[model samples]
Target chain A: MHHGPAAELGKDYSIEYKTRLGVILFFIYLLVYAGFVFIGVFYPDLMGITALAGLNLAFVYGMGLIVLAIIMGLVYNYFCTRHEDKMNKEAEL
Target chain B: MIYTVSPSAIVIFVIFVLSVLGLSFYFARKSKSASGYYAAGGNIHWFVNGIAFAGDYLSAASFLGICGMIAFFGYDGFLYSIGFLAGWVVALFIVAEPLKRMGKYTFADALDAKFDSRAIKLTAAISTLVVSIFYLIPQMVGAGALVTPLLGFPHWVGVVLVGSIVIFIVATAGMTSTTYVQFIKGGLLIVFSTILTIYVLNNGIKLTPNEDYHKFQTIPVVMEQDKILEIESDSYHLKTQHTEGGVTFVSLDNQGIETWWSLNRSGSEPFLEEALSIVTTADGEKLYNGAPKTDGRFYQVGHASKIIRNGQEVTETGPLGPFEFIEAIENTDVTRFLKKVFEVDGNKVTVFYQTITPGKDIMKPGLYYKLGDKGNLWSRLDFLSLMLALFLGTAALPHILIRYYTVASQRAARKSTIVAIASIGLFYILTLYMGAGAMFNGGLDMESSNMSAPLLAKTFGIVLFSIISAIAFATILGTVSGLIVASSGAVAHDLMDKYMKIKMTENQKVNAGRISAVVVGIFAIILGIIFKDQNVSFLVGLAFAIAASSNLPAILMLLFWKKTTSRGISVAIMVGMISSVLIILLSPTMYEIYGLKASDAPIPLQNPGIISIPLGFITLVLISLMTKKHRATK
Candidate 1:
């Protein structure tokens, strides 16, 4: 049976490579997110501590999660595009 | 509680609705083919689709509900924003590329691509319809909520108006029109919210007693030898006195108008606190502030009682940065109103009295979520379950999944998602400032938290208020139309053509979709009217739980697991959807909705995500193994 995705990303860009990188980045974000939730649920007093500047840990950590997701998304796109371009040219040669 | 209909608001609202309708008509000619109607011909630009994703994703719940929650409850609302934006991470990293490559038009197409299973198509189609309806109810309820103040219409009128407009948009141009509409809405929502945030920061923190309705005036009571005597007032005469629960409430009359005031004693000094009340007599007559509803006497509430900066109580902090605004609120004493209802002498009285909450408590969790050592295990588990649902739900939403097909290729889908993450992430950050702004400014409606952001805009000026309210209406319209498109595609493409094997021409398929949109729109209006009193954000959280529990496991397993048989997929979906919905219906929240005691509910959990999500994964794995062995025996 045919396998992997139906749409071709590039001539030789590895699906395994992209999926692996994505899973790793996803797990990294998940770990950080779990920390926020853990602190919120179990150690509610900790979220009130001043984390950065004058903002409370709840505000700082909450805003941090949103900012980190955007940065990670851009980073994922940047690396995937670079690998896709290089690999596709090599296959043509 | 009192709203004066502004003509300018109605005019601006009409123009916004007209322009959105005009765009739909302009795109109608291009949506003739089934492909164009369903997937926008798979030709949307990655940048536009990305912003459109933001437009489609940020329903009235995001803009109105979260801001209101933060305004009233503080940091808990921002928790929703964090969880919501985090869900997009799952969308981008795990779901985007493969979904774009596998599916043609609907989410069912991707699921059934491997085995061409009719059972998969039917179950997925049904799940899409159920989730869309669950999501649509809140948008319609939000539409009704905005209409009452902005247009001075009844709640049902707002529901019918949004349903009709969204139906026309979806039935005419389908996804082609929907994408452009969402793009415009997404752009307008971000720009106007940023403007509102700027205004909030510029105004800074201030102690506003909201004396526009009635100034807070107290008179010393005349006492005779340790005995209580009547208080003297030049303009008001004491009319009636009733003491209940050790608090003496006296009705005071000024000319022909009357209102309730409570007696307070500090040491040996006695004073009175002014209050606002809605009284309904046994004769079935309603009174606002002890007068007619149209007396225009209800005061605008919500302002800082004391603004403390560096341990010094100040009248106001003129201008502050975004971080400074939050930091300042942390030390302030905000004037919040609490409502209490009771029947005295067979007349029902609801009194809204002032409460002083420190800014530090306002920025913490306990106001709404009930966490920490003070909260029980059930409450903490409920909070975690809701966060889990919000995180996993975004990737599983049918309307969001359908947007992946609107882009031209897998690369376009991936790139567009990054754009959505950035756009939506910035908007969520702005919500924190606006929410705090609403709290310290006189912008809250004691009756509904959904009106906080718009009413906050009113404090700036009527023109800014008009523009912001119209954009909120557009927010509702954009999300409702996207839901209808997803629903129509499920009916025509997945259920009828794929599962039933209906041999229909392109024109007939498009006709079927239009019919389905009309039906779904009417159904949404009915539910919106029925559930008008329910909280907008709470209903949305339920939608997320259902989607995450039912659809996410099936899609994730199909993508990552080789042994996921078609029968396993079908049964897992049915079991997951039923279990999540059943738990929600039986949970304490629904018991409260049913007018029963919450403690009587069999299931103690408020949210079903933690249990149902794991249940979905386990069921899928177990069923797949058994089905594989059966196939081998055959």
Candidate 2:
């Protein structure tokens, strides 16, 4: 596949940067899931505490996925715009 | 029904109305462009939009219906909460960004983005209006229900009051005021519900034995050659019988009777303390709480308390966590409960509580066809089909789909969805406790399960009762506004401007949308008043089924299926829309709504998603194949 215009622009700028962001997001999801499992297994008493009240692990993980999707979209947009501008300049040249 | 209208409830109602009107007036100036009116200029913050999503999604059905169900039916009501939250997964993962990228304002915009077809636009717009109206009925009914107890006004008065207020809100500000109102109300609903759940857990369960409660008795008499027969409480019966019956009978003892009994060591009590004691005596056999009488005398049929696992009793060593509680219930016999029924003399009195054990086939829908036996395959499939429709339908809802356009970019759309999921998911978890708390709180109005949560709050105090009820009303307003906006956008943008080729500037388009909003709001109010007595959640479920059948197939096909021509999408929408609506209108639900006998129903039941959704996809494929050559030539 061509990786699309967006992906090409990301590569030209720094593939390493995008990869790092992805890795960070993956870890965030990992942390949330892990936290819930820990609470479920060890600190069971704190499961429904009012302080932690509405913050369930499943919810945190779900929210993390949402955050990751948005970040991905933003990265994709940035690359797509840059690539489109560059392509237009090259055509003019 | 014997409720005194509290001053606080009146004040809160007035304040809410005024605040909404104020916001409407403020936004009225800015809502001159179509984008501003329909999409709030597409510049709302993700956080606000996310909460507004909660506001739009959680109507009377979510706030009142689930809670009432839980109060009356125990865990069964909470199952609805789980189902609703599950549907959000489809919206977040599957539809969020793609919808944002595709649509301008309405759900039809996304489906017809590539096609630019008049048929698609008209069909999709009509679908949006129909679904919105269906959903509005329940909210309006809920509004009327709230008014009876909260304001001491009649049900129709409540419907008209809410209808007028909502119309003003939508007509004045369009989406802008609705969004903020929803945001505020959504936040309050979550906070107050959490507080109520805390109160419930802290109070814990209480043992209310059959004794120590007042029981009312009714005596029936035959008079005037059995033509002017009458049944009344002893106090009223004496007077009526003397005048009407003109028959000398035994002296009836008239006194408010109270019985006192102790709870068994196992700690199980009758469902309703007062309701349980008035057992029906048949052939000198006293039936206590619907349980079979052992001797031909009054005996205490105490509730047996045991920690049940799966379908059998188990021992709980100590307090369990939430998930653990769910697990325990899943694996144990903790599901059995004492039920109450009331009946008259010589007839099996339905006025006693019977111990109920949900059968193993409880999870399978339509398992109990004739009440005792499990339902057959068709019924089971129908239930699954309804659930499938609900699960996938959220992403396709016109109101929900339009929310994606409120944010600026696809990334923002995705992020806002994530935030919504988190917030909504959190709130749904709270609903479980709130529902369960209401279930066991002994404050449920059995006739109307939707009153469970609010009535539960009333048990605490009128202040909380007023606030919770008001927030619940706001919940309906928020959702109704979102739906009106969606329908109006569909009419003004997709149908009138796009399909009908009406040339209009942004200002004119905005005016058209505003006018449409008023019209839709009026229609919604009328339907709401019409369906004032039906269950709100059931109505919402029908809306979901329609949304899934009519919109999901076309949306999914356009995004993923390349061969999905414009003709295919248009055909799928039309088929889905027509079939689901027709099926619902002819189904058993319509029998009651349309005042017809059950046998007169054209379809088996109201839920038609199982057959209709698949039919929509199949029709699209066949039509696309037939027109493939024509499409290529064009």
Candidate 3:
């Protein structure tokens, strides 16, 4: 089982950095997504209010969560790529 | 229930299946080594893999189930979409990069990478098999649903057809062909769904009554509770019914077929005292709820019962923007069918009577979620558990997790996941419009909610319906293939090679995988046939619950916690898989499957995620503490 270091496989990165940002963003996303579930389950009446056009709060909030997921994904990708690259460059030096 | 076969749909469907088989044969020769067969030699492009992620992830549940749910009930079905899409975030940000860097063939590879232990392999492999089998059921069920209208085949034939095709796909090039099929179908599904949606929007909301159909008058007659009385109608007596051994059996007319009606004691659904319906078609043929003795007519199943425009009742509303369209519908009247079995002329008849539901009520919550049920703890927990399972299940699904291993690098995995999220998110948005459009399309099949989307496309024309059903069929093929490939890898690589320590030749490994694919394929087909008429949405929910509870905890713990021992991971995986499967079998849904009363179920909730998932986490933590001596010795 002994060969080159396992880090060479691209698994080595700043665990602290990734976990910190990942947990933070994860909680933020869960909070928003959970909000959608809670409102629908508990406050059924609020979802009926046609928020805009014929789109009710139910539709708006759900769509918002979906759109937010994309935005959050792009955000995470950007920061994580930059952070990982910086770590790899430092590791090379 | 007599769904006439669309010849055009059959032609297109056959062509699609043939092309997919051709692609598989070509890829089969291209792949040589076991590595090549299992993971495509890790050479897949990020973009293709990303789209394939969407393809495999969407499954029949996303396409058929959500759309059908929305068409029947309202926006409540879209909640499943939000939960499913949100799961990819956990995949992309947390699981994808780490998994790709560590694992080779299966999800078990990642778990066992940290500790060279047989327990991890055995447990993870078992989890993969259980989850994949559960997932395969809905895809098979969906295949049957699509074939009923398109190919004019019975549901079981459709199940077997998909099973055989998916087995051939996996047994050939394994992941190589599976990825390409997913990529092609994933792209086609979105493109065609968009085109169908655009056509629906262009046509706008229109009230077009069925040429042959006529509404029945509800004559409320006072009758004795236990006495059998005859309420005569024009054509024939309603279908007869009798209660024997606590099961209410509605004996259909010589021409009528059996259909599952939601058996509930709660009078939430509508019922009439005198059930009378006599639908006389233009050709002087007698019909029951718009179906004849011979070839039945497609009744106006999902039409808006009433439409209001600018405070006035109007039959036609011209083309409107997406938001405006929903707004118009909110204030309008949607005539949705509510089914109830009643005695007429001493015969029990199950009539799907039209109810003019307020558009506002349809547009809001509580249609399917029962959100207003404050007193029911089980209802609240069940709803939350289903959403939780869907949210967590995506990251844990064996078919989905293996896609990361097909790519070259961790970054590729993350990028691919992001692509998947974008594509899947857009498709879900389109599903809302499609579902609502189908709801009032006046062409939906009431008996099979899974047929809602394809039947809606039928209204556009034969070509559109054919293409939609064909794409849906391909969607099932792609998903089932990916699942079979995953299960095969678990059997050949993880369980046999790693845990059993077979040390077989490369050729033998590939042979083992092929054999497992066929066996699993046959098993899936039998299950598909047994649970023929199950709603795809509910079946998919069970699959998600099992996957989330079993696989997610093990993967998350191994990645985040240093003290996570091999014993802990194995225990967590086994406990999660077993408890979830046990809870599912004991749940109310299973009680229904047992042909027993819902009240007979020992478990209050149908979903097992809330109970089993936390139980998995607790077991892992406890076991890890007990086995912490190994960590300290190291």
Q: What DockQ do the predictions score, one after another?
A: 0.50, 0.05, 0.49
Task: Kindly give the number of clashing pairs for every candidate.
Answer: 0, 27, 6
Assess candidate 2 and give its lDDT. 0.64
Error of 3 at B369 (Å): 2.1
In candidate 2, what are the lDDT values of residues B479-571, reduced to their tens digit? 888888888888888788887878888778878887888888778777877887677877888888888888888887776566777788778
Error of 1 at B623 (Å): 1.4
Error of 1 at B612 (Å): 1.8
What does candidate 1's lDDT look like per residue over B92-134, in tens digits?
A: 9899987877788888888887877778889999999998999
Return the lDDT, model 2, position B193: 87
Candidate structures ordered by TM-score, highest first: 1, 3, 2
Which TM-score values does chain B get in all models? Answer: 0.93, 0.80, 0.89
Off by over 4 Å in 2: A1-93, B209-373, B596-602, B629-634
> Could you tell me the lDDT of residue B218 within candidate 3?
39
User: What's the lDDT for residue B468 in model 3?
Assistant: 91
Of the candidates numbered 2 and 3, which has the greater DockQ value?
3
Best by TM-score: 1
How good is model 1 by TM-score? 0.94
TM-score of chain B of 3: 0.89
For candidate 3, lDDT tens digit of each residue in B1-634?
Answer: 5666767777898899899999999999977778778888788999999899888988899899889998888877888888889998888778887787778889988878878778888999999999999999999999998887788778899999999999999998899999999999999999998998887787777676344333433322223453224333343343454543343333223244322221122254322332223344345555554456344533546666578888888887878777777787787788777655444444444556455678888877777766655436778788889888988888899999988878887777789999999999999988888888888776556667888788778888889989999999989999999999999999998888988889788888999999999999999999999887777988988888888888898889888888888888899889999999999999877888888877899997888999999999999888998898544122
